[model samples]
Target: MEVNIEIPSHFLCPISLQLMRDPVTISTGITFDRDFIEKWLFSCNKTICPVTKQPLDDDLSFVITPNHTLRRLIQSWCTLHASYGVERIPTPTQPPTITHSNISKLISDASKSPQQLRYTCLQRIRSSIAPATTRYYSSRCKNIIVTCGGIQYVANVLIEKDATRREKEEAVFILAQMDGYDQEFKSVVLRNDDYADLFIDSLVGLLSSESSSNRERENAIKVMKMVYSVADPTRLGSVEHEMFAHIVRVLRDKVSKEATKNALKLVVELNPWGRNRVKAVGSGAVHVLVELLLDERLDRRISELALVVLDQLCGCAEGRADLVGHGAGLAVVSKKILRVSHVASDRAIRILSSISRYVGTAKVVGEMMEVGVVAKLCLVIQVDCSSKTKERAKEMLRLHSRVWKNSPCIPPHLISSYPTN
Candidate 1:
């Protein structure tokens, strides 16, 4: 009885028992001393949430049914949490917000002003956000902001052409930014399949709202450039409209410049199955493109768009050939004697050569060769530097002779007619 036993003063921390209280862990990661822990437990009528009385049926069991002797050891720790807010302490490292207001404002203002003022407005917009704000891909808003930012930047830069050639193209750069943020946008796309369709239609509607100026084509050209830049060609073919006269207007007009070219570029990128819906834009696109090809005054952009649409028409093995084999196909050929200077249309050269390869499309080709497209092909073959253009031109000639064996090759100077019968 003379010998006395003493308990060790050291105890486990209420939060992470790896150490003692000097500090001890409570059920909610709070650290306290035995004294405070015991007091709080007693104050709360033992084994219950102090705040909500929800019952401390949680981890860090020391507080749940803390033995009075040990709980008293943690008593001091209870005051630390009640004084300091724990809910405010969340994991660090969050991302920034996406701000597209400036971009939208500038574009809206530019659309209403004179063309010269519009360029200046774009320059101001580009200078403000071009280099820094857009450098990294944003991970926050499911990439909707990224897509809009890209199309916005493209509106500013595409028309300028060399706008960012030295600094990294806004369009291409935005696309690359999206690549890093794919998971974000992909989720949006999965949730909303019609987003792309809605997006394009909205932009088209916005640009057309400009009533005073004919520069809408220029606006559409730049917008379409960006859209087609990332446009899923296979999915793009499904896009159609009843008011295609607007696009036809863009192609045939001298003011719009590259307007139709943008439209045609999207048309060519599509898979064959997709081409039918795009082709369904009625004969307005075809009629205007053909007529424009013959006019020397017609801008290269229009010619290029027409040629591309025509190429897609003639090159298709499906019902597109049916559209071409009849009067529509002949009408285009009867107009253009030679598309000598209009080389920008990828649709022109690609589809010309492509059309020659399809056996069923020969009726269209027969009309093609007779329309002076073959002689133009021959001229292009002699000197066209691009391996692609040259190769396709060569194929056009071969198909021309094979399909139109009886039709003599017409000299480049004269327009050739399809057999009227």
Candidate 2:
């Protein structure tokens, strides 16, 4: 038979009715677990202690000192009842404080401390920067971190003479984490004309630096992606040529799966701007994307992104020319149309549409016929693709049917099914 032992009511938090972990005293002279009280105070915004009904005040400046005596007594009771599967509570360390004021003070202290103390402070700040860990605790903390100069402090650590590689990586990682959690912070940085370029330039420098680790490079790209996501068209138009080159280089280097995806996204996001598209074409992004498409082991999501980018790039004459110029480009794009997901298929068909409509010289037309693109279009109509996609395919085939149908490059059987515009 299993036996149950009663936990002393004095050892239980009044709010939770569970044995307290890290019990703390409020101004009401009542003790509750630190986690419960904090949530009540900060998240629920309650001014009174749960049991005493005493006012905690709007300012909430009460010190939440640990009740060591109660904690020890709880541990003793657990030991005495060990036969009933009772376990002793481990000693509790300080839980993360969710207040914005505490967060601002933390940032200020880290920024002003001496070298050794500063590093310690940076570590403390780093702990609070985790989105996965701290996001549920407070949104206000994220605001404090950004508005209180925390980001600048972390960046300064990267340039500090005595900082170790690990510390530098931590700083970069913290910035990246902040970007993930805080949308308001992202908007402020991108919209701030004084800081946007300088901030991006620093990330680019870190991405290009020989001494930065692979992880650091990943963090840099992540931060770059977040910044670019919020930047307006006018601001994006202001991006320099060297920045595109670095982005292309990161894609070429294949830093990580995530890094590569973000780099591709950054390129596609910028391609809508004429100047950015020209810069990307100049950086050989077309060739790099085509090469990535040729990889048999590429993840489906990665392939989808690659095709999406290729479709965007093909909007410009230069992008279309690059696609036609590569030896396997037309054939590879045709192969992907029906084989991949609906989005990839749509993007692939659009790329073929661009080539057929805008750049369809006799030779390019002949090549499309020979590469099975015409047959693929016929198959698109027969398949269960989206109506919009089927319409595009039919239009592409009709646009070049005259040149393609009579040519020996097209198969005799498929030619009869070709639709004339």
| C-alpha local distance difference test of each model | 0.46, 0.76
Worst 10 residues of 2 by lDDT: 114-123
**Regions of model 1 farther than 4 Å from truth:** 1-198, 207-212, 231-237, 242-246, 252-255, 269-283, 299-302, 317-421
Q: lDDT tens string, model 1, 309-385?
A: 67655544543554354464544543442343445523556654554565536456666765666555655555535
lDDT of 2 by residue, 164-197 (tens): 6566677778777775544664655665776776
- Alpha-carbon shift of residue 133 in model 2 (angstroms): 3.6
What value does the lDDT take at residue 370 in candidate 2? Answer: 83
* Deviation (Å) of 268 in candidate 1: 3.7
TM-score of each: 0.42, 0.72
